[model samples]
Target: MGAVVLIATLDTKGPEVAYLRDRLASLGVDTFVIDSGILGEPVDITPDISHGELARRGGMTLDELQHAGTRGRAVEIMRTLVTDLVREKFALGEVVGGISVGGVGSVMGAAAIQVLPVGVPKIVVAPTASGHHEFAPYVGTKDVMVVHSIVDILGLNPISTTVFDNVAAAMLGMLRAGHPLGPPSADTRYVATTMLGNTTHAVEAMKARLAELGYETVVFHSNGVGGPAMEELAAAGQFVGVIDYTTNEITDPLTGGIHNGGPNRLRVVGELGLPQVVVPGCIDFSVFAAGQIPSALAGRPVYDHNPEYALVRTPEDEMRQIGRIFADRLNSATGPVRVVVPTRGLSIPSTPDGPFWNPAADAAFLEEVRANIRPDIPVETIDLHINDPELGRHVAELFSTILDSTRPKEALA
Candidate 1:
């Protein structure tokens, strides 16, 4: 592990930032602080890289930004610079971990998410972490950690001091427990899988079965972040095959759910020539924040998913659009593919006699997919629900067969 990157608007929180940096130093973790404040003068510690370097790297000048007389321009340039600098440092193995201390609506927190990759130790200390619901714009699919400061980051007070000490410790601990990504193993290729709470059994079965097939299973939750991370990494050639058993993110936008992973959800893996076995695991319903005022999904069937999120049934019309999206993306595949539809159910509550059960909608959804899918691509219907333990085994068998077929003649029996 290298120096922990500390970022702050040093012009305002210079003394407080110094305390944070020194606190981590006391714990034996070296600190590299980035200055992002444009309005005031930085004090005490010299910035390794200043706001001038950032603006220049962003294809602009600090003078030009000043001449433009807009703080927004400064914010934009600093974000671009920080993102570029952080990524460069990470590639050079200079950043082992990172922390950004910012006030409400600071672009610094959002930039932290942009710069850091999935597993790197990244933390953002901000007031928004205390219950801010508008999260995806800031976090996206990154694995950055966040801590609520409970107070604005100005001159250090008891609460601010306490928050700073706790955050420093957390960052130090994360760096001490270091993690570094290894080169992809050639002995066993990666198999990416997706799972929701509704499909946990299927994922467990798939993981064990794929292990026996000599393929490592990488499961991504179909949450807002996980789906995007899996797809992007797949395009980067991280996985040899994908058992995408949970495609619920596709319908999230159609039904106004917070878990909507961007629209480019299924576009990457196909373009990368990765073999895949897709499933309609839990596309039947959309999830909404429970207890809070729900999205304006009038007349749609809704059920309490948990205390935090509510589940709502997808209309046949929206399901049809999702079907077309599936076909359109899969049609571009340069490798083998499969789409599995569990005939009895799509989710736990979508099965017959369940709360969200509506056979008509399910039939409409499946029929559209079956009809629109490329003729060469096979779409199979299983007689079980998506969560049924056997469905996992069934999908695993199909995926293993795909892997076997792709093997060279000399590598096969």
Candidate 2:
């Protein structure tokens, strides 16, 4: 079995790192340590990979990094170097898991582990994980686990010892049981799809229908992270096609909503030229946490999604803008694509007699999309609600048609 890699800045964290190394050794796990310190000499132990060698691999001497004019610049250079080193080690099958043991270590170690493929067990133990720090840098779009060390990682003590012990044990468990990273097998036909609480029933039905069509569905929630993570997997060739059923992430960037999936949300699968069915599901509103609603939207209809989130209805103008954005992105698709719309409602709250019902606003989006999208792509509109099982079945049939059209005749046989 390969060893678990431990990362830390040895200058300031030598004693703590040394303690963690011994703890893992007692658990029958081999350890490979990397020192990212740039200034002082390592105190308690020698690392398998030293900072000096790390600097050399990055095309500079340790002294050159130390004199890089600013601490941030030096850290950036070391971070990139460590990331490349870890990637190479994983590629060579030398890494079973990874652990990073301090605040700064968490940041640098996360960059390294993010370069590793999915399903690799990566952990970050830091006091910062307990507080109100933004975790995007630590987890990014990967599955890295973050453990909050109850006390600061200054030195060995009873509390710190217990934490390090558990970290080692957890790594061992994952290394023994976790699935290895790789793409799906040739015979496994998987389809990627997205959904939200508002459209759960529809997606469930869609999944069943896709299963009946001899394809398995990997459904992603349309939360801020889920959409991008699905796209990342799609780019890795993990799916045959996509049913983008909940696309409110597109309205998020313009409305400052909390569910924003960044600018690349709808671009990846299209760029890959995968057959896709795009729906404007949940596009009638922008989401915000309670008490965080902006004053500009004071007069708009607000639906209380829960105690934590409020959904504000999008107006006609914003819907038109979203429509154009969707059309422009879809126009760049190099493969089979279709646009499906539910004229009765885009979400539960936008149904007739619902709080967010506004046919004029919805119609504005349809007009803009039809006007701006390419003439070859077909746009289908139905009179059912977005969550209707029939709507999901219809989408499944549409995706099947496109997939059949794109497959080679030999594969179809």
Candidate 3:
């Protein structure tokens, strides 16, 4: 690892930024401090992107971009510039690790670093870490470490110095630890798999089978964050294939369930064009806020596994929407794709005598998918239940076939 770049708004936090730069020097590492503040002149910066370039990229004059802006707007503009600059530096292998310091400013700068490929040491020392729930998840997903600045960023206090010094030491240690993007291995190709508590057995089976074929499997919980994080990894080209076992979150999202997958859930398969085999594994129910269940559905069927999780039978109408959404996302694919439907039952709760065991709803969902999906796309419907060993085997076979089919044939050139 070469010199670690210390990125911050050196205009306002000059003293604090200087401490971090000096601390890195003490540890026998070179440091480049870049100033991103557009309001005032920078105190001390080695390789600075001037206010003029920031304003030019931001489409505003330096004075206008600074004076007309609140802290948030300034942060947003700075973030855009920083994201572009950091990506460029990373590609050139000039930056080993990145550290940012500030309250609002730190979040913006850290966010830019977060956009960098994972495994690079990313640290943010911010006073707002305690209440930053929204930004925290993005940081965690990207493996960016956030350290709480004990005192405010107004000036350097004892606590502030201690915290910043520790952060500097940690960053130094991370840079020295290993090179970013470690030595390549022939046997390991990361495979991301989605699973829920109900679908864990099938996923485990599939993972074991995939491992036999010489691929590592990363299992993601089908909760809100898990699915998105998996897609993120896929977009980064880290995963070779995806076995999406638990499509339950899409049901939650469509039927106003509490655990919706948002708009990005199934889009990654289309965007990245990775070999994917999806199933209607958990589309049997619509999760919702306990009190939000409709009057018609209030007593039809309900199961409360815990305070945070409750299952309600999905109606026939809701299933049709789920099918359309599923088919629509799948149809947009330019890559190899497969949709598997377990006709007998999609989840444990959808079996006979279970609370959400409604075949009509499941049938309606599948029918809509069959009716709307592109003819070129393959939709496989199996007779076994979702948890069936045979169903797991079928999933493995489809993924294996699709992945094998995608490998480039040799000696054509």
Candidate 4:
């Protein structure tokens, strides 16, 4: 069995790290401890991978880092070094699981473990994990388990010991019974797709049709994180094509909606030269929390998705801007790409007779897209609602045609 890796800032968290290491040892588990502390000497224990070695890996020394001016810069250096170390160890099969204790340790440890594949066990024990801090930085697109320490990790105490003991036990259990990720199947061709509540029926229908066409479908919620996560997996060579059924994340960055997918949202699969079918699914609106709509958009049509979320319709000008953004991103595609638009509506609330019914705004998007998009890329329009099953099946067939044409002759067999 491989050893479990423990990470901590040894100057402050040494005792807790030692206690957890000892507990794991008592349970017959081997461990390698990494000290990420920068300023002071390690307290109460020695680390297998000292902060000096970590800094040298980044072409710097402890003296240099101690005077790095800002704590943020020092932490950034250590984060990069530790992340590389953990990734190397995991690649070499030297570590089976990883745990980090305390606040700074949690951030560095989570960054390190994020490089590991999905099945590896990674845990972060920190007071910040207790529902108070935003978890996106720690959890980001990975299967990291964050446990609240309950008490500050200054030293071993009743509460701290219980948390460490439970964490050790949980790590051991995961190591013993967790399923290891194996190589992808040679016979299966996987396709990645995105979806939202507004485009559920369309995505489901596409998934079913893709399955019938002998392709496995991996569906990702097109919320802020899910789209990027899907892109990450796609860049990892996990899928042959993408059915981007819901692209609302594209509008979030423009409107300051909560589902912002950042700048690289729609560019990954295209950059990888994978055949992709794009849709303007859910582009008719931007979502905001209740009572949080921007003052500029307050008077526009709003649909209360729930008490927590309000969907504000995208005005014509914004839609036109979104269309230009879409065209720009899609124009750079390195492989076969197709854009499909649902003329009747882009979301349930935007359908005819619905609260956000605005054909002119939808038309504005289509018009801008056609005007600016690369002339080589085909733009197909369907006179159907975005959720219509027939539209989904049609896109699936369209994707199949593109995939078949682009696939190597050997792959076609």
Candidate 5:
């Protein structure tokens, strides 16, 4: 196996990158450097074909990106380019491991490496190592490791040099140990799907169809980590397509539901520009633990779906906010996006004569979408209930259509 491709904007990180390259060489490992600098002297390793090429492969190119200067451009360029490059390299068995270093740029660029097949020795040493990793969800259950370089990423000082050397050693050891590459040769196209208990039937149905169609289905519980994790894979170009079947987590987050998926929930797919089909699967209510329900909702109807999970019906006011957030996110997607709404009900309890049925709140959210999301984004509202087999199939077909449209024409050849 070859070296773990050490990726970084070599222009600004000349000293640090060179130090890492030398260390890896000394350790008897081959290293390939990718120059993502927009404007600078020629780099040692092949540069990304072009900045526009990076944007076309994912989003924003290095040259067209709005950054501060050469350093900033290199950072952005490397972040996006390295992710795509590493992804491709790992796919082709050209790399056994990957390492990256930077502050925000390093973290962003390295996130792609982290998403590589589990146990391929992924390590990222970042300058900004404090706080909740907004990118952790994408890393998922992968064995990706992070080392904090307490000092800022400037020239290679004693501190920064030590950090990089240690990180390089860790990655080298991991690769040498030779962890098992996951199950033999199953080209399972990963399909990222979202689910909550209320929307289990639809998600399962979608999963069944995807499996029948020869795809590996990864069902995210949508219990805070699920949605974000699924989105992370999408951003890393890990997902062949996505079925955003249940978006209630956004409402859960907005209404102080114990299961909030955070603000960057919809951002991953939008940034990665993937074919997406969204539904208000469980939008009618927010989930919470029985004890965490607010006093204001004391008299409001509360139902225990299970001992561990409880549901609180959303009020008209909160639904408006949910609508605003959803619309704002959907409007920003650059890919072929479609939002599907089930008019009959969004969840099990929201069905006709069901415990959580409330048309006013659902209507309010739908109205917001109609008014705010652009016409080009494609909004489809169905008359059937969310779990209805007909509605399920309709959604599945819609997602299939969008996915097919997004496929590269060359694949057909």
Candidate 6:
């Protein structure tokens, strides 16, 4: 195992971090400390890479970084250098699992750890870890583990010590557990699937078919975080093909919904040149958690998905916009691809006479997709709902054909 890199602002989190280093040292695990702080008086514990060094590495000096206007920039610079430094060290087998303690003003440390590779046993202990909305961004698509300190990390008390001890043990546990530290292995090829609650039947059906065809299926919920993670894995060459069944995540960004999967959702799969079967699953509604629906949409009809979640119908205009975005993305694909629409419905609730049904809006989206997509990119419409068994079967068959066509084979024997 490479050394456990202790990350923190030695100027502020120095005492607690030193205590942690000493504790892990007692346990016979090698440790290295990196100080990302910009300004502070020196502490008794010297860091392997002091804050001063980090500032210089970030193209700033100590005095310059102390200014109010430059502190945020300095932090960002440090994040860049630190990420590169840690990644380099990891390639050389100098760093492995890591731990950091944060309270307030600890954004830099958290940012640094976030850059570490997934499955590296990285952990961040912060008071905000429990309910902070920022948690999702901090660990986007990465498997970085966060532990809620439940108490401020300002001083080492009973709670802090117990928390630190647990973190140390956890990090060591993961390191010794022989976790992956670099590029993923390609022992088995997998298919990536993006699904939503409304598109569950389709995904389940496709998954079963894909398994029978000897390909692994990795399903992602097309919610806020799932879409990003699935896409990130796809970009990393984690899948042989993508089943783009849930186009709902893109609607969030277009309509200001909380589940905005960012602007790069469908674009990643297309750019990868991976074979895919795209469907307009759940694109008819924009989902939001309880109490988060925008004021402008207050008058619009919504489906009370549950006490904690809801969805608002997408108007015809918005459907057309989503279609253009979808087609623009698919047009960039270098691999085999096809767009299929379930004419009867996009979701269970959006069926012909269902509460969310609106053929005018659906037809608008479909027409836009056909108009904007490349002439060579086929667009097919079936007289079935998205969740219908017939539609699922068609999608599965199409994906199977694409997967086989995309598979690399020997030219001649």
TM-score of every prediction relative to native: 0.90, 0.92, 0.83, 0.94, 0.59, 0.93
- Writing each residue's lDDT as its tens digit, candidate 3 over 132-189 gives 4446532745777888887877677788888878988888778777445543366567
Q: How far out, in Å, is residue 293 in model 6?
A: 0.9
Candidate 6 runs further than 4 Å off: 68-70, 181-187, 408-413
Clash pairs, model 3 backbone = 257-287, 258-287
Clashing pairs in 5: none
Quickly count the clashes in candidate 6.
0
- Each prediction's RMSD to truth: 2.7, 2.2, 4.0, 2.0, 9.5, 2.2
1-413 per-residue lDDT for model 2 (tens digits): 78888888888888898988888898888988998877898888899999999999988899998998899888889989998899899889898888887876679987787876688899888889875787777887888989998888887889988998888888888877886568889988999999999999999999999999999999998988888988999988899889999998999899899889899888888889999999999989999989999997899999999999999999999999999998998888888899999999898998778998999999999999999999999999999999998999899999999999988899888
lDDT of each: 0.79, 0.89, 0.76, 0.89, 0.72, 0.80
Q: Tens digits of per-residue lDDT for model 1 on 138-211?
A: 56666677777788777779998898899888887776676645557777688999998989997898888888
- The 10-residue segment of model 3 with minimum total lDDT is 132-141
lDDT (tens digit, per residue) of candidate 5 on 232-294 = 657656677788888877877666776788888876686577778888788777787667787
Residue pairs with backbone atoms closer than 3 Å in model 4 (clashes): none
- C-alpha lDDT of candidate 5 relative to the true structure: 0.72
Residues 1-413 of candidate 4: C-alpha lDDT, one tens digit per residue = 78888988888999889999999999888999999888887899999999999888888888998788899988888888998999899889898888878785678878887887877888898988977677877887878898999888897789999999999999888888896666568898999988988989988998899999989899998879899999988887788889998999999888899888889888888888989999999988998979999997868899998898999999999999999999999888898999999898999998778999999999999999999999999999999999999999999999999999987899878
Between candidates 5 and 6, the TM-score winner: 6
Model 4 TM: 0.94
Residue 350, model 4: Cα distance from true site in angstroms = 0.8
Stretches off by above 4 angstroms in model 5 are 1-188
